[model samples]
Target: MREIDVFIDTEEIADFFYQELIKRGFIPAEDEIRELADITFEYLLKKDIIAEEWDE
Candidate 1:
């Protein structure tokens, strides 16, 4: 965990990855996204502003 707020670069790279994922037909369907939302939340548990119990 880096204590640096590189939001600008983060957003830029996130957009790039998002577009690449969409292009690869790897875009998650709405239902799948909903399902994976829990996984994403678990990941966020290791991050600040979202520190929840990651252990299932």
Candidate 2:
């Protein structure tokens, strides 16, 4: 069997989350959303669910 890899853009995810927050009437700073997105990514990394690219 071949293993498939997936990649996720944290910045794009942050932007989408920010927009959703605004639509739901929650006001959050852009940096705050970015930080949250980073944290989420880190958690996934720690759980071995995602891998970070260091050769970019």
Q: Quick one: best lDDT, which candidate?
A: 2
Tell me how far the alpha carbon of residue 31 in candidate 2 is from the true structure, in angstroms, after superposition: 1.0
lDDT of each: 0.52, 0.89
Clashes of each: 0, 0
All candidates: CA RMSD in angstroms?
7.9, 1.7
lDDT tens digits by residue: candidate 1, 1-56:
56543222334445555666689889755555544555555566556445433336
Highest TM-score model number: 2
lDDT of 2: 0.89
- For candidate 2, lDDT tens digit of each residue in 1-56? 56678888899889989999999999999899999899988999999888787865
| Model 2, position 46: C-alpha lDDT score | 99
The TM-scores, one per candidate, come to 0.35, 0.80
